[model samples]
Target: MKTNSLLLYSCLLTMAACAGKNNVPATETINALNLKKGKTIFCGPADKQLGAVSFKISGNGKVQEDFNMALAMLHSFEYDEAEKAFADVIRKEPGCAMAYWGVAMSNFHPLWSPPSKEEFDKGVKAVAIAKSIGKKSKKETAYIDAIGAFYDVNAKDHRARCINFEKAMEKLHLDYPDDQDAATFYALALNSAADPADKTHAKQRKAGELLAKLGFDKSFHPGVIHYIIHSYDYPELAERALPAARKYASVAPSSAHAQHMPSHIFVRLGLWDESIYSNTIAADAARCYAENAGIKGHWDEELHSLDYLVYSYLQKADNKRAKQLCDYLNTIREVHPVTPKVLYSFAAIPARYVLENRMWKEAAVLEAHAAGNDWKKFPWENAIIHFTRLLGAVNLNQLDAARTELKTLTALHDELIQKQEAYKANQVQIQVKASEAWILFKEGKHEEALKQMNLAATMEESTPKPPVTPGEVAPARELLGDMLLAMNRPAEALEAYASNLKDRPNRFNALYNAGLAAERSNNAGKAADYYRRLLASSNAPGADRPELTAARLFLEKQKTLAVR
Candidate 1:
């Protein structure tokens, strides 16, 4: 396999050289010949296939291939492995300034969360070491300086530093227009600095356009394809990224993150089977990598992929698989180097299991801080636990318990606001208002309850989901439909569910309940149509979710009526 890969890489390089002589773009020529699926020529460890990446730098001549492999790992967001690869390069040649730069880059995850204090200090120290080595070419210096901006001590915060870093990368990209590394990293910086509230997706669109110029369809560079997926992760832009999403895993199948990243688009498009396939491989890959590396506990990537897997399963009405995942989650006693991603996944998986299944009593009893992680570090994640519990309490008419959960949610909301996490704070506020509305309905304040619920739904509809989560624990609009249904307003309930389904398609609860609402409104035809959709989307053999059963019975009854 290695020999074959090397031969393919040689052929590609030869083709590019020939194309350059003929004044033709190499990527376009390669695309024309349909040779775009070739693997990276440079070999790293047997298990780490991080697509083609080459960034020439002033490094030990023998370590250049290793350096490129490290850069590829970094592009795939396999930070731990990338850091080790870079460190190995430094051991081989301590004067390799670019190797030190890779170490610094590994510590700064652009899209996930800001570095911890320890990570920040490590990045700063690595940058200092690279600067002290100080014999880099102009291009290498530009790369170092761009990353250094993110570690600037005088910057107000991570966000401010992100903007500074983006500006620096923009300059570097402009200076080296022919450099694929510069363009790919610059596109990533643009996405990292994007404002989530900017519904126009201006930064995202710019990033996507920049990636497109790199011949995204034909380039085997993992970063090019990976960043393209992220650049188009938004609902409005998801379809544009479908091709990249479908192609990324094949390009770098050995990277766990590469396997998982495609599901971001899959989930957005409500492609449950595709998402399940992606994350299933990703989770297993993560586990295998950890075990092979002799790591004692789960990697955060494993948990992250599992969360996506569980979510997709629930959406497909594959409750048996979803339950098995929840069981698997419970067996995990530890995750190595617990980051925000790990915490969010640990908290979210169970919350999603209960809420998605509508196991109201189970949700009511769900414990917070159960993972033994520091919940205070992530108020948004903590709020998910409380919000799920609140929903359960409200549904079960446990008014006092619902109010208690609401109070805790309000406190978390205030905490997020104080931290200047406006997006998360707004999300928590929606939960608070929804919980309050449900509690009011239980108290017989029907008009007031409906009004408050509507406002919450609107607020939620305006807020796009963060990239970290599969979806909200319970979407506020769906909750509004539930409230309307409970109030015996089936027509209004159907409208609410229909609108929510447009944004979040193929949801089991929404589909089943939408059908129920249609039936209650005396629209048997519409109800049957919804039931058929539900059945078609969820064909898990022998899977018997009550909702699926209800849908089946409804359809059968309709068929009988037609025969009569």
Candidate 2:
């Protein structure tokens, strides 16, 4: 049945091209591309398999295909490519109002950080141009107005503007229930407007329901599947998105974002192999796209993918690949547009490498603001470096150095609060508390250390991780477990490790430490179970990591005892 759908879709595209209509009916396109779990039909450029999308607009038929392509790119968060495609449509037909809308839409990434000042200006200009072209259909006007809400100069607050845009999209979707584009964009807006503090994930769940109702299993619309993944990108809901995560790359293989997006769910589920595969391809695609586009340095997508790649590889104890990636990252002199995404990845990749490997001295000396980029602009990113340095200093027994790092982190945390970045501020606070806890532990204040560590862990548990990172640099709960283990309270340490693992499964260090804690507590069965899990999670053949070796020895001993 899936094969038949692919064949029918190909035939439809061919028939449309041959007939010179340049327009495939939306219903027909959706029905023809209703692919199931199987082989994907590659229908376009090798680097541009944007699954079928038909957003019929009042424009020259000659530019219809280009418009659709741009729309698909927009859905996949390929902003640069989408902007170029929209520009091409405008060049061919100056009166294409919706094309201008597309350019404006490209500048406003709903799920990403708010546009930079330059990008915001560009979007405002595009919206103005679109409105100036007065002869527009009601549908076109609605689309333009919906995007215009985001570019509203009066609405300086990005969140408020996002809410307004969501309201606008809701009306548009209601007015045109049959329009797949309207429904998809509406769902995306809902996801974007979702309150991060709301543990219920009310808006995300609603968005997921809306997308699912659009026939996610059968619909080949990249945005539908992509948004479904975003809508369910939470720990509690991640499993529900596994099917979509498994299928998204196949649907839009050309999109770096599409390839990388699956890792959000994959990381949440601790599916390291799947996450690694997704990020490796995504990083390559991003590099290819950057080179082809004549971009001066790395694209943000490439850096983003590399960050995830480093994380997944480290999880599997593949330090060789992670080190190679770090070398590549070190060689990068610049990024195309240094957005928050790029900044986060820049800070995280190295931090993850040092912290994951537990290279204390190396981490202690790690530089902050090493790149020429202005670290002041992103206090949260700067905090990553300080946090890592603090952790390393504490481990190395450098009390003064740890306090200095902690002081810097505290200042950065204050800056985050001043910027009204509540979510980022909360994250930094967690780091601050953790750093203080470790410093206290080193100062021989075990009770105070545990108290601070538990506070940090509680705060971390209450906050859902943002989609930008795979996981925390060092989870506070895991740190608490480490503190307890160091205090020789193995039973309490084991309990803490178990709790942390429940939230963030399959972390190599966590697994090994949990096993060690259990063994020390004389729960041999639990120790063996955790040891076996650690071995299973790390698939690197013949890996001689001491942790891996220890797990192997412990498990083997348990097996021998069982046989006896």
TM-score against native, each model:
0.89, 0.90
Any runs in candidate 1 off by more than 4 Å, and if so which? 1-47
Q: Would you list the C-alpha lDDT of every candidate in the order shown?
A: 0.83, 0.84
Alpha-carbon deviation at 350 in model 2, angstroms: 1.9
C-alpha-based local distance difference test score of model 2: 0.84
Per-prediction backbone clash count: 0, 0
**Tens-digit lDDT track for model 1 on 514-536?**
99999999999999988998888
lDDT of 2 by residue, 1-564 (tens): 224433433454454334333222233322232211211222225666888899887865889988998898889987877877787776677567788788789889899888876677667656655665656689999999999887776674889889989999999999999999999999999988988888899999999999999998998899999999999998889998999999999898878788899999999889999999998888888787777766798777888888888999888998988899999888888888777878888888899999988999999988853553998898998899889998888999999999999999999999988888899999999999999899999999999999999999999998989878888989999999999999999999999999999888899889999999999999999999998898889876555678998888888888899999
What would you estimate as the lDDT of candidate 1?
Answer: 0.83
Off by over 4 Å in 2: 1-47
